[model samples]
Target: MSLDTTTAMPTNGRPIPDPVPNDLTLPQSVDVVVIGAGIAGVCTALELAERGLKVALCEKGDVGAEQSSRNWGWVRLSHRDPREMPLMVESVRLWKGMNERTGAETGYRQCGITFSVTTDEALKEEEDWAQILQEYQIPARVLPAPEALNAFPGLTAPIKGALYNPHDGRAEPQKASPAIANAFRMLGGTVHQNCAVRTVETSGGKVSAVVTENGTIRCSSVVVAAGIWSRLFLGNLGIDLPMLKTTGTVLRTDPVPDGPEGTFKFQDYTFRRRLDGGYSISGPQTGLYEITPDSFWLAPKFFPALKSEFTRLKFRFGKRFVQEMKLPRKWGATDRTPFEDTRIYDPQPDTKAIDKVYAQLQAAYPAFQGVGIAQRWAGYIDVMPDIIPVVSSTEGVRGHIPGLFVASGLSGHGFGLGPGIGKLMADLVTGAVPVVDPSQYRLSRFSDGSKIAPMEGILRR
Candidate 1:
């Protein structure tokens, strides 16, 4: 595949093996209807099925087609918010046994992840944060400058030290979600592709079912793991979910036999070794935000986050503002919604940004000098106001729509935290023992008098 930055469906990305899709035949009823077939949705369905709950996994497009597969495939516990630390710890644990649990290959490897810092201040911050990881008894430690650079070969990026999390690793993005979805199907879960869920039908403020483009499925509960489309989908239901999107561009290299082992975060760029022998590379440009109509409407909630990352994020206007304005905010259940309109949020990769990151990667690691660029792509990341996720039910609001649970706004941490989120969501839905304490991820935090803000400071890695 030629690394055409403008291509929407880049062929280089691991194509999720198309399974026996059930979009043609809609199910009559299910215990739960999971909207979106990303990592979180698929794993949630699988967990629900494992608990013997009939689940219908619906997606506007193919499984893992969006940010689920478009992510850097990094499964890490380093540099995470303390609120999510426990969940990430649980997520990493789930990641370890995913291949066996799904009876498929997820390309999971615990080779380790090294987050290098170029300054002593950053190193000190990381070291201070290591205390929380130590509380969890996670195998994470701070290494001195000399020892840090030695963790990965050819890591010539000028750095003072690093926080090495040997337990933090990666899984193949393209393969993991699809494999899990396939396993869910084998477990008797209905997998629907190209089935755009228009809206959730509520009865007396409780979710009665979800109306999809195909037909209505009488589900007791609905989990909106709709990634970037969550806020839009919820907006039609009168739920004011304060969320926004940021573009992330990633480039994959051709097979590099001697690429640095595991994942490494340079001062400007980051790379992870893939199963196919190539390395997925990205840089700070991932934080770029496009100005849309929602940006102005939700500016008050996001003002703090924007101010915190003023110098870090790049914002663009014009096209996105007009594009989002054209999207229907109020649609009837019988009408075609925007979910069907935009099957995949495939943004154009910034060619110049990719070139710059590539140049910097070669400069840092001379071993990557002549490696061929196989493919480059970009996807939008849905973020929340407090820079965390909402994996709770809809009963927190004034209108209080019951039987509706949401697991969206994972920001950029969805792929890594998918399993933990799924397990926790299933626990909440099934009234079973939670995988972790779900207090921090409640939907009420935004509406309640609780000071809705980011627990961690700027530049959340």
Candidate 2:
């Protein structure tokens, strides 16, 4: 659980050569060109390489520098869309066994996840989710407020009830990301960091080459897994992705005696079981967000429903922070950058937002009242209009674009289910029977009138 700052530096600076490739003048060809080095891209490349494919993984920033490393490391399946449940289950399995497979410490812990609830309606919803889990034979149960309090002796938040899932867990996103990327390299996959791929060449409706700042590299297949920047990468094909940006501002406090002693879970509105000894808490709230329409450069489609949602979220922040006077709260935004436009946005953590979050944290956790504040920052989570991932190929784009595949639109839920989606992508590419029905995630779902009805409490806030 130690935080090592050294591994993060490679994401910046000049382009580096692939570990296996010595000649720099763009390799003539590869079986697959995987774009973006985050969880989605790295997982996809690792899966593909495991299938014996020659894979090339590219990244514009440091590995996992974006949302991959900048997320709450909760690996739980409670309150997920029905369609995504299977993927979440499989991802949990992968996460549980990742350390053995990759030989890297990922800080994976099956400590389970708990959602503290204050209202009867929310409890009913939790019961409903329990039914869903029961049907799937997944271990889920409702823990009443008193029971939850007993589970976490020091949890002082006022709670009427809570939901617990024994099978769910957590992992260090920062550690897991690079571990998986390194696993991909061990599988003979080539990774190119700080190598911004610009244009992709297509002929007869298939991808023929991928053009980056360094030069053109021949590729039969391409996977655009560039988190929030996915739409920008596809813009060259005149395709406007219906992706949006959601911001999450998180902060860390100085290690405290009761740090890792609290519940190894998170409450719905605020709080998470930090792997680094101390608990990290946030208001049970989803922060600011914006959507992209038909153009990457176009103004965001501010979904009107979110305003009221933010209001309630603000109330939650105030309520939670009012009780805990020690925790600090930080805040910031996810950006809207095209792949070639990384220079257009700021990668630095938002200090202003961090200060705000610090104030909120101080009010929430008693142990955090006089604790020294540590690091804090923000990251963008890409959301779809329907708030689901778009995993199938680009529709109506012609024959395979040869190898141009899309596995994005995670809608802020990417980290938890990333490994499973990557495995699914590999199965499709390798002509293996898919583990789950991917039809639910087909790219056409958006335009084909198969919208994911918005979760009442999700989008509006």
Candidate 3:
């Protein structure tokens, strides 16, 4: 299979620069092939192309439709895993200039991120994190309750205080992914959405081509950036990853006269003040549980009491969740057909959850007292058992495969760390000085009898 590098206008309406003759076909062989169209894949392609390498990036779905777009858009420098801080720090820099890089409105904001704590335990943990961040010269501090209220002016709830990181901010993940993908195309890279890689063709123990539904793309190297689906790709090469899908629910409020001017996180979930005077809130990033279709049925088997209440109270189940529960248990493990309806897993707002979230928000900040609930949606994210991302090449796979790489297992931090990981992966692919040490994210670490401990809940955050 060859790429007919004809500069045809994209059906999606994004402009494509004219393709040169050499660009018309995939090189009989290429320098690299990247799988997954999310941040990691596009970023790596852009970086490699910038360094003068021929790269091809393919995706099983539209870019960022999964964990990348499904995340709570916090681009903060606070509450980072020490190992991931370098990436976090550099991500903030890239985020600040993302518009120039992608030529798109990504909703980037540097309004700062505040973590409100009401207990001595949470406060102590915040203090500890402050010390570690300061060690890296990252600005972080625990503000007094009075000062916190003064800073935000609308935080009316009673609490000990809050930890503030001025360098932290956010962007609209919904728009950023596509924007970056467009940027990658403009930079002389190739991206194929709805194109799934069937298998990595290898010869003499080296990757020779990426067989996709469209055609065979011969390339010496491949990078796997598929989010939760990354493990499935590696499985094709005989590698098993301890990654799972975790669901999160979020709610939006009707445009109000006023709302919190910035973003906030508390015991129940975090709330981000939207540009439209509404707000978005979600569950704790670490609280999602392992739930299979059977788990819904198993929820009753495991906790008959909750099941009884679910039936007795007529507790509502999100449509997607209910449908997912009806599917065979194997569906979660084996369903691989990629759909174009981007909303295959898109969920409607949970009224009950929204009411609870609204109450909590009102309790935490009174300004939300009369905020009318407008809409809500839910999404799933990829999570590692240990909650640390495992990113590296598969062992025993070499040669043409030598250039193959991986940058996934984001474990709910994809939106926040996408830019940083993208930058680092790009560096590794181009063989340039890495933005952050790769050893921290090497996949072999977990197999070599060393395990990275999961974040200590709010303490580590």
Candidate 4:
């Protein structure tokens, strides 16, 4: 298929220049065609290409232009859902060796992560969570007041204790995905940027090809890792994916001397040091939800999650509500879809929230009082009703769409879980032994009469 050479508008977040040139010609056919060039997509392509399968990765925008690059760069297993703990464990293991495996600096570092607490109730909650981690042989522990202070020196505020994980880590958000994509390219995988896939074409009730704005490519399997755009993409194929989006704002500070060496999440804010000597900071618990048509349609499925995280999510209705209402939910393969309309989901940063977090950071640690803001931006996160990702195939069921697999709905945790999830996805596609049990992340859970709720005592951060 002949491809287009149009370049997308420059993304607004941290700049991640193209690390590898995109493939201009779409192959006539491949063993597997993965849609969306985010971390999951590239990782999946890399795994398949390394396994000697012809792979093609398609992206509507630049790699990691959305949540992958806009995140706080935390690769942690400190306070994960119990169901996701195993996957996170494997993900951290992959992250530790990612730079060597990919031959690119992913900026991964085992700097540890700490959650500070100021009250006995909060400390008890951390202690309870630590007990769960112990069952998995994860080396996470709770420190008492004196010990917590000594572990995290330079704290002016008094704290009862903290939950510390020495193995938790961080990676450069802008560098990780592109590095993996480059690795895939080195392994003979094809990547197409500014190539928005309009719809997947099926034949004989099975996968056949995908129709992109550029053209069509035949394949036996397809993996949709389009992040926030996954719901709309699947909806076009008559699939009801229960997903909603929340906007998260963040800011980077000028390189300041002697900031916290490790990632830290206190009562009001979170911050982690960058490789460039600056610090990425944001409100650990703050997120803005813009009401949309899907918000009402999927409310029942998300009621439990909404109630559990009500204190952290701020609701608003304005341009976003009107904008989403006007977006076409269904489109033909030949049509110009919303994916082309907005190449990247770049939302305006909530200055109110960013400033509030900055103020709290200064109040909690006086060292941040003189830090200068370098840049501020916002990205939308796609969250599932259960706050867990769906990583299953759509085959052999009633009215099944064979050879279709989804690895989306990461719920703001994609960056840390990308490598492991990608490896698992490659196994699922090729019918090999999975790296971790895949039953918990099955897509059928939403429709199979299973009770959906966040794991007990899971941290919102």
Scored by CA lDDT, what does every candidate get? 0.85, 0.66, 0.65, 0.84
* Collision pairs in model 3: 3-26, 5-24, 207-401
Candidate 3's residue-wise lDDT over 355-412, tens digit each? Answer: 5766777776667776665555556666554555655666533222565687888867
10 residues in a row with least lDDT, candidate 1: 9-18
Per-residue lDDT of model 2, residues 53-75, tens digit only: 89888777667777787777777
* Candidate 1 Cα misplacement greater than 4 A, ranges: 1-23, 458-460
Q: Clashes in model 4: which pairs?
A: none
Q: Measured by TM-score, how close is model 2 to the native structure?
A: 0.82
Error of 1 at 241 (Å): 1.0
In candidate 4, clashing pairs total: 0
TM-score of each: 0.95, 0.82, 0.80, 0.94
Where is the poorest 10-residue window by lDDT in model 4? 1-10
Per-residue error at 133 for model 1, in Å? 0.9
RMSD of each: 2.4, 8.5, 8.9, 5.1
Ranking by lDDT: 1, 4, 2, 3
Give the worst 10-residue stretch by lDDT in candidate 2. Answer: 327-336
* Local accuracy of candidate 4 as per-residue lDDT tens digits, 349-426: 876678788878887676687777767778889999989988878653333588999999999888899988998999
